[model samples]
Target: MSQLRRILVDAFETEVALRRVFLWLPAAAGAGVVSYMAADREPSLWLLVPLTAAFAGLAFLARGRRLAFFLLCGLCAFFAGDLSAAWRSARVAAPIIDRTTIGVVEGFIEQMDFRRAGARFVLRVHAIEGLAAAATPYRVRLSIHRAPPFEAGAYVRLKARLLPPAHASLPGGYDFAKDAWFARIGGVGNALGRIETAAPPAPPGLALRTMMALDRGRNALARRIDQIVGGDAGAIAAAMVTGKRDLLSDAAKDVIREAGIFHIITISGVQMTLVAAIFFVGFRRLLALSPTLALRYPIKKWSAALAMAGAVFYDVATGSRVGTERALFMTLIMLGAVLLDRQALTMRNLAFAALIVILTEPESIMGASFQLSFAAVAALVAVYEARMAAAAADREDGLILRARAVEGERLRLFWRACKNLLARGPGGLLFATFCATAATASFMAYNFHELSPYVLIGNPLTLTVIEVFAVPGALIGTLLYPLGLDAWVWRYVGLGIDGIMWAAAEIGRLPGATLHLPAFAPWSIIFLTLAMLCSVLWRTAVFRAMALPLAVIGVWGALCGPSFDMAVAPNGEAAAFRGQDGRLAVIASRPSLFASEQWLRADADGRPAREAVKKDACDKVGCVGYLADGRSLSLVFDKAAFAEDCGRADIIVTPLFAPAGCAAGLVIDRDELKETGAITLLFTASGVARRAARTPDEDRPWSPAPRRKWGPSSRPFAASRPTRAASSDLDPSSVARAAGEAPGSVEDEDGDASPLE
Candidate 1:
C-alpha cells in the first residue's frame, strides 16, 4: 500500500501524468454514465447535488496535493456524466402508449422510410382516436403496407393498430423500449386501412418546414439516382449517399450485416472521411497551381476549413443519425486540429471528440452504434500510431537509406518498392480491417450475439469498391447532375454496388462466416472494453500488460457462460426448450417469428423456427417439449389439456390461468408471464436457474411492473410430496455420449414435425 501510494504521488507530480490525467477523464465520464444506465432503480432526484458537493469538497480539501486534486477532478467529471444523463432523460420524457390499441391516427408525417415489407412513417401525432390528449404520444412510428400519397409534412389520417413500446423478449436482449424512450418515440405498430389526406389544424413551425424541405430534396435525389442506376444496386447507391436504406430488401441487409461490411452503406467515418479528403485534396492542388499565391498563404489550413464545411453538409444532407453525427464530430475535430496546426490523428484528439459526444448524448453510451463506432476508430488509430512509430525508428537508424545506396541492390530495391506499395495499400487496409474487427468483436457479440469471422476478407473487398468507385461516383454524379450528365457516372456507381453485393453474398454463403453465440453476462462486455482501453490508452508497459489477462477472462466468461434450457416469449405465444440433441425444440408450430428468431439467437442455434419446431407434438390442444433430462414441458392451449399435462409433465405453461391444484413442479400462466415479461430458465446439474426480461424489481420507466389482477397460488409446488426434487439433469448430446449415445446424436421426439401451423 505504501509503495502504491508513492507511485501515485510520483505519477501525479510528473509532467507525463498531466497528459495521462486528461487522457483518462473522458473514460471516467463514460464510466459514470455506464453506472447510471446499469442501475436497477432510479436514483433520488437530488442525488447529483450531493455527488457534486462531495467532489467539490474533496477538491478543496486536497488542493495543495496535485495527486489528490487530479483524483477529485476525475470524480467531478464522473459526477457531471451521471447528472447529464439524468437531466437528458428527464428532458426527453414523453408519454408512452401503455396498451395496444386499434384507432384512427391523424398526424403530419415527420419522416418516411421504405422497407422490404412496407413503408414506415414517423407521425407527429395530432390525435389518436381513443386516447386522451394528455395520454397521446407526440411521435408514433407506424408501418404502412403501400406507398402513401403524401410525403413528409403532409397531414394525413389513417386507421392503424398501434402498440405500446416493447421491451426485450429475453434476458440480455436489446431493449427497444429504452431506445424508444430516448428517441421520444412513444408507440410503434402497423397501419390497417387506407390513409387519407387531411388539412393541418395548425401550421408547422419554421424549423419543421426546413427539415421537411430537406427530406423532400433527399427523396428527389434518390429518385433521380434510381432512374439512372436502377435495381437494388441503385437503391444501395442512393442509400450510400442519401441514407434511404429501407429501399434495400431485408435479404440484402442480412447479407451485408453477416459479411460485416454494413458500415459502408451507412454514412459513417469512412464516408465522411472520403468526403473531407475529396475537398481537401482537390482544393489544395487547385491552390498549388498558383505557386506564387500558395507560398504566401496558409492553403493547407484553408483546405482543412473547406473540408470540414463539406463534411458537415454531407452529414446534414444524409439525414444524420447518431452514428453519422459521431463521425462528423470526429471529422470536424481532426480538420480543426489541422487548422490550428496541431496533430490530428492522435488518440488525444479522439478522446477530446469522445468527450463532446458523451456530454451531448450520454445515453448513446448504451447504444451499439456508439460503442462499435468508437471502438473501431480507437483500434485503427492506435494500430496506425504504432506502425508510424516503428517506421520512424527504422528511418532514424538509416536502415532504408543505407540499403538504397548499394547499386547492386537496385533490382531488389525495385521489388521492395512494389512490396511497400502493396503494404501501404491493400495490405495496410487488410491489417486495419483486422484491427477494427478484433476490437469490435466483443461488442458485436454483446449486441447481436454473433461475429462475422470472414469480415477480414469481406471488408477489404467491399470497402475497396466503396473508396475507389462508389465515393467518386457519388461526388461526380452529384456535381454533374445539375448539368444533366450524371447518368453515365451512376452506371459505374451501380457497377461498384454490384461488386459490393456480390462480395456480401459470397462471403455470407461461406461456411461459418457468421458465428452466433449464446448471450453472456453484461460484465463480459465491460471487461472486454476495459481490456481494450488499457491496452491502447495506457502509456506504461506495466499497465498495458494487464490487458492480456482481462481479455482472457472476458473471452472465457463469454464462451463458457450458462446457456438457458428454455425461453418463453414476451406475449406467451411462443416458447422453446433445449432438446437432448442440444438444438432448440420450439413448442409452438405456429410461433411468433420475431420471438422464435430472437430465442434461437439467444441460444446460439441457427436453425429456422419451422425446422426447430418439427419434432414437437403440437396441436390445437397444446404442445409437449422433451427436455434433455427426459422431463416434459407442456404448453397448454385448451384448459382441458391442463388436467393431463399438469399430472404428467414436470412444467406447465399456458396463456390461461392455471387451476388451483397443479401437480406439475412448476407453472407459469398468463398473469405471471405478464408481470415477469419473457422468462428464461437454465436447468443445470445443480438446480434450475431462472431469469426474466423484466422482473417485479425492475422499476425503469421503459419497462414498468404490470398491474397484478390476480394473486399467485397459495399452495407451494415445492412442498408437494409425490414429485421428488432431484438434481438429475442430463448433459446435451455433445457430452451425453457417456450414456450410450453418439456425439451430437439423440433420438428425435416420436411426433409430428410438420410446419408452423
Candidate 2:
C-alpha cells in the first residue's frame, strides 16, 4: 500500500505534459462505452441529451477543481458526441432489404477489389429500375465474374441481385453489418450479366471530380508498377505504394499474415513516419546547402513543415484509410510541436492526436487497427519517456556515485567491455525487436486469434531491408511516376520486395510458426488493456509490479476453455459438435467455406475443413449422428426423415417447417433459426442450453426482428410411431425438464421459443 501510494505521488509529480495525457483516458473510456452501447442497441437521443447536459452541469458546478471538472466534462461530451455520431451513421445511405428482386442497376463505380475468383466493386447508386427512389440503396457492392475496364468513378449499368449487408454468420463471429454501417456500404449482391458503360464517364460536383482525378492517377500508377514488375511482386509493390491490395495473391497474403509482418504492405504509422523522416532530413540538408537561407531562417521548423506536407501527400497517395488518417493526425501533432518550439514526441502530443481521432470518428475506437496502432505507440512513448527520465537522474547522481564507487581498473575495464557489447551491437537491435514484438503480440492475438511465434526471428532478419531499401525505393518510384521513369526505381524495389517475401515464406514454413487462440470474451480485452495502460502510464517500478498480477489474470481469462459444446449455423445448414477429444467435428449439408472458417478460427482449431468433417449416415432425407456424450442428433431434410427421426432422436434440426406433434426434446428448424440467427448449444450434466447470435437487447435499426406469418402446416407426424429404432441416447425427459418444459410435452405450441428456452 505504501509503495502504491509512493507511485501515485511520483506520477502526480511528473511533468505537466505527462499529467495532461491522462485526461484523454476518461474521454476514451466514455467513447468506448458509447460505441459498445450503439453496437448492442439503438442509441436514444432523448436519454443521451439529458444525461450529457446533467453531467455538464455537474462539471460546471465542480469548476473549483479545474482538472477534475474538465475531465468530467470531457467524458460526458465525448459520450454524447459518440452516441450522436452512431445515430447519424445508422441513418446514412440506408440498406435495401428486398432480396427477391433482380433488376438493372445503374451507378458510378467507386472502388474495385479483384479476388482470385472474380472482381467486386462498390457502386454509388444513381438509379435502380423497379424500385422507388427512397427505397433504393445509396451504395451497393457487386461481385462480377470477370474484371472489366470499369475504373473507379466510371458510370456503369448492370443487372444484379441486391440485398442488405450480411449479418454475423455465426454467434460471436465477424459482424459484417456493423462494418458496412460505418463504411456507408448499404447493400451487397452479384452481377448477373455484362456491365455496360454509362454515358457521363465522370460525376458532377467539385469534390467528386477531385476524387475521380486522384483515383485515375492512382490507377495509372498501379498499371505502371504492374508493367514494370510483373506477377505477385508487382501486385505487392503497387499495394505498398497505392493501397491497391486486391491484386495480391492469396498465397502472398497468407505468408505475410503468418509471419506477423502484414503491416509492411499497408500504409501505417511506420510508413508515414519513415516518409516524414526522409522529407525532414532531405529538406534540412538542402536548406543547409544555402548558407544565407540557413543563417536567416529556422531550418528545423522549415524542415518540419515540409515533412508535414510530405505526410499529407503520402496519406492521400495511400488511399487515406482510417489508419492513414490516424498516422497523419499524429504526424501533424508532432510537427506542430516543432513549429511551436516544443518537444515533438511527448505523451501529450499522442493524446491530442487520439482526442482528435475519437471526436471525429468515434466508431474507430472499436477497430483493431486503431487499438493496435495506439497500443504500440503508447508503449514506445512510455518506454522512451522513462528512459529519458532515468538518464537525467543518472546525470544528477553521477558526481555523488563516483566518490562512493571507485573500482579496480581491471573490474572497471571488464564492466565497460560488457556494457559496450550489450548496448551498441546486435544485442541492442535484438532487444528493440523483443520489446516491439512483446508489445504487439497479445493485442494481435486478441484481434486475429493467432500469433506468429517466429516474428522475433522474421522481423530482425527483414527490418534492415525494409527500412533501407523497400520503403525508400518505393517512394522514389512513386516520385518518378509522372515522368514514366519509375521502372528504374521499381526494379530495385521489386528485388527488396522479393527478399521480404522470401523471408516471410521461409519463416512461416517452420514448424509451429503460428499459434492460434480461441476468441476472447469482451471483458478480457478490456482487462488486458487496462493492465497495459497501468504498466506503461505509471512512472514508478512499484506501479509496474502492481500491474503484473492483473496482466497475468487477464491473459489467463482470455485463454480459458470454450463455453459451448456445439454451434449451429443460423440457416440450419451446418453445425459443429465438440467431441470428447476436445475437437470440433463439422456436419455441413452444403459447402460453406466462410462459416466453416469462422467456426475453426473461433474455436482455435488448427485442423483443415476436410479433416474436421464428420462422416455420418447421411442421405437425401438427412443425417443422424451421436455426439461425444452419446446425445443423438438428427438433421432432417424432408418429410421422410422428419417423421422417422422426430420421436427417436434426442434433438432434431431441420431446414423445413416443424411438423406438428414432433417429439424431439429440442428442435431447431428454419423458423427458429431465422428468427434468432446462429446458435450455440452448451451441454452440461443437467441439460442443454442455447445462445443466439442476436438477443432481444440487440434491437437496432440494422437488426430488425424477424417477421411472423401464418403458413400452410406440414403433415402431422405421430410421436407414438417411430420408424427408426431408438438408439441408446440421453432421455428426452431429462432434456425437456432442463429446458423448463413438462416431460414429453412441446415447449411452445406456436414453435416460437426464446433463444435458450
Candidate 3:
C-alpha cells in the first residue's frame, strides 16, 4: 500500500499530461460500455438533457476539485452523448418486422462485396413495390448468384425476398443485427434473377455526389491495378490501395490472416501514417532545396499541413470506414499539434483524438478494429516516450561523453559500427516488428479467438518489402494516374506485392503457424484491457507492478476450458456436442454454413462443416445420437418418431409440438425455443445446467420476448395413466398426462451462466 502511494505521488508530480489523459479515458470508456449494454433500449432525451446540464453546473462549481468533479462531468456528458447517438441511430434504422412478403425492390447500390459464389451489396432503398414509404427499410443487403456490372451509386431494381437482418447464429455469437443497426441496414435478402438498371447516376445531395465521385475514382484505380497485375496478388494490391477487399479469394485471405499481416490490406493507422510521412518528408526536402524558402518560411509546418490534407483525401478516397476515420482523426490531431508548435505524439493528443472519435461515433468503440488500433498506438507511444526520456537523462548526465573518452577510439569505432548495423540493417526492423506483434497479439486473440505464431517472422519479412517498395510505388502510381504514367509504377508495386504474398504463403504453410483459442469471457477482456492501459499509462517502475496480477488473472480466465457440454441452435435444427477428446461433434439435420461456422469457431474447432459432423444418423423425422458422456439425445421432426424417441432419449429436441405424456428428462420444443432463443446445456454430475440466449432481463427493443396470447390448457388425460398409441400416430395429451407433468417442464434449470451465452 505504501509503495502504491509513493508510485502514485511520483506519477502525479512527474506526468501531468499522462494523468489528465488517464482521467478522461475511463469516462469515455464507461460511456461506450453503457451505450453497448443499452443498445436494445430506447434512450430518453428528457432525462438525459437534465442530467447533463446538472453535471455541467456541478463541474463549473467544483472547478477547484480537479480530480473528482471534472472526471464526473466528463463521464456524464459522454454517457449522454453516447445514449443519444444510439437512440437516434435505432430510431432511424427501425427493423422491418414483416418478413414473409416477396416483391420487387428498388434502390441505389451503396457498397459491393464480391464472393466466390457471386456478389453481395448493400442497397440504399428508395422504394418498395407494395410497401409504403414509412414501412420500407432505409437499406437492404442483397446477394446475387452472378456478378453484376453495377457499381456504387448506381440505381437498380431487382426482384428479391427480403427479411429482417439475421440474429446471432448461436448464443453469444456475432450480432449481425446490432451491427446492421449501426450501419443503417434493416433487411437482408437474395436476388431472384438479374438486376436491372433503374435510372442514370443522379445522387441526392452534394455530399452524396462527392461520395459517388470518390467511389468512381476508387473503382477506376482498382481496375487499372488489376489490369496491371491480374491474380490474387493484384487483388490484394487493389485492396491495400482502395480498401476494396471483396476481389481477394478466401484462400488468399486465409494465407494473409494466418501470417498475421492482414492489417496491411485495411487502410488503418499504418497506411495513413506511411502516407503522411511520405508526403511530409518529400515536401520538406523539396522545399529545403531552396535556401530562401527554408529560411523565410515555416517549411516544417507547411509540410505537416500538406501531409494532413493528403491523409484526409486518402481517407475519403478509400471509403472512410470506421478504421480509416479513426486513423484520419489521430493523424489530424498530431499534425495540428505540429502546426501549433506543440508535442505531437503525447498521451494528451491521443486522448483528445479518442474523445473526438467517441463523440462522433460511439459505436466504433465496440469494434475490434478500434480496440486493436488504439492498443497498438498506445503501446508504441509509451515505448517511444520512455526511450526519449531515458536518452534525455543520459545526455543531461554527460554519461555519453565520459564513456566515449574512457573507452577511446576502439570503443568509438565499435559504437559507430553498432549504430550503422541497427539503423540500416535487420536489427532495428526486427525489434520494431517484435514490439508491434507482441503488443497486438492479445487483442487479436481476444477478438478473433486465434493468434498467428508466424507473425514474428512473417510481419518483418513482408512489411519490410511493403514499406520500402510497395507502398511508395502505389502512392506514386496513384499520383501519376492523371498524367497517364501510372502503369509502370503499378507494375513495380505489383512486383513488390507479389513478393509479400509469396512470403506470406510460405510462412503460413509452416507448422503451427496459427493457433485457435477458445473465446474469452467479456470480463476477461475488460480486465486485460485495463491492465494494458495501466502498464502503458504509468511511468513509475513501481506503478507498472499494478498490472501484473490483473494480467495474470485475465490470462487465466481467458485460457479456462469450455463450460457447456452441448449447444443448440435457436430453431433446434442444429446442435454441437463436445466429445471426450474435447472436439466438437456437430449434428445438423438442415445444414447452414453460417451457423456451422459459428459453432465450430466458438468451439475452437478448425475442421470444415462436413468433417466436423461426427454423427449424421437420420431416419425420416430427425437424428438421434449419444453424447461423449453417454447421454442419449434425439431430435424428432415427425409425430411417430417423437413417440418412439420420447421415453428412450434423455433429451429430446423437436421443431414441432411435443406430446403431453413425453417422458424425456429435458424437452426443447419449438414453443420453448421461441421464448428462450438458442440454448446451451452443461451436464454435471448433479444434473443438467441450461443457458438461454435471451433472458427475462433482455426484454428490450432489439430482443423482445415471445408474446404468449393464449392461456395454458389443462391436461386432457388423467395423470399416472398411459393410453395405447397407434403405430403411425402419438396422442400429445395422453403422453403429457402419462408423464404426470407439463411437456416442456424440466427440473434443475440453471439460469445464471456465462454472459457470453
Off by over 4 Å in 1: 1-18, 60-64, 286-297, 399-423, 482-484, 587-590, 609-624, 636-650, 708-757
- In the range 1-757, model 1's lDDT, one tens digit per residue, is 9998777556444525537557778888898888887777776559896886799799889989877887998898888788878777888888898766789999888877755455777788989998899999988877777776668879998897777665666776766677778878788877888899988999999988877877877777787887788778888888887887767765676888889888767777788888889999999999889978698999999999989889988888889877777788888989999999888888887888788888888988888888888898888888888778766774564566565687765666576567667768878888888888888888899877889999998878777777888789888988888898989988988888888888889989999988988878768887899898877776566666779999998988897765788887665556788889978877753565555667788788766555766443888878888888787888877666655676678887776666645567877766666677778888766666887777466677677666644555222324222553222222233212211211110001110110100
Worst 10 residues of 1 by lDDT: 745-754
| Winner of 2 and 3 under TM-score | 3
Give model 2 RMSD, 1 decimal. 7.1
Evaluated with lDDT, which candidate comes out highest? 1
lDDT of 1 at 540: 60
Instruction: Give the poorly placed runs of model 3, Cα more than 4 Å off.
Output: 1-7, 17-27, 38-43, 70-74, 77-92, 97-100, 200-203, 285-295, 399-426, 482-484, 579-582, 613-625, 632-649, 654-663, 710-729, 732-757
Local distance difference test scores for all models: 0.76, 0.69, 0.70
Clashes of 1: 1
- TM-score attained by model 2: 0.85
Could you arrange the candidates by TM-score from highest to lowest?
A: 3, 1, 2
Score candidate 2 by lDDT.
Answer: 0.69
Residue lDDT tens for model 2, 1-757: 9996876766555623346546455445445455654466666667767777887788888879866776777767666665556555655637554443578999787776654456767788888889888887777777777777767778888898765665665676666666666666666767887889878644566776666667767777877786788888888888777877777876787888888788767776777888888999999999999999899999999999999998998887678876778789888999888999988887777777777777577666666777777777777777677657755665565545556676654465466557656744777667666766666667787767899988877777566666776679878887787787778888887888888888888888899888999877656766677677766666656556656887787888787734677777665666777776878777756535556666787788766655777755566667766788877878766554554576678777765555545667677776676567778888776666666788744566657666755863212222232444343243444433322311111111111111100
Model 3 is weakest, by summed lDDT over 10 consecutive residues, at: 748-757
- Candidate 3 local lDDT, 1-757, one digit each (tens): 9996886877766655456445445445545555655554556666666766777788788878867665767766666665556555555555563443478988778766554457777788888788888888878777777878767778898898776555565666665565666666767767887789976445567776677667778877887787788888788778888887767876887888888888867776777888888888999999999999999999999999999999998888888887778778888999999999998887666777777667666766667777777777777777678767855774554556665666555565567557656744677666666666666777788767788987878777666766886678768888899999888887787788888888888888898888988767656766677777777777766566778888888888788734577887766666777776777776756555566666777677666656766555665668876788777878776665666787577777776667755666677776666677677787776666776676544655555656764765211212222443342455655544333312221100010010110
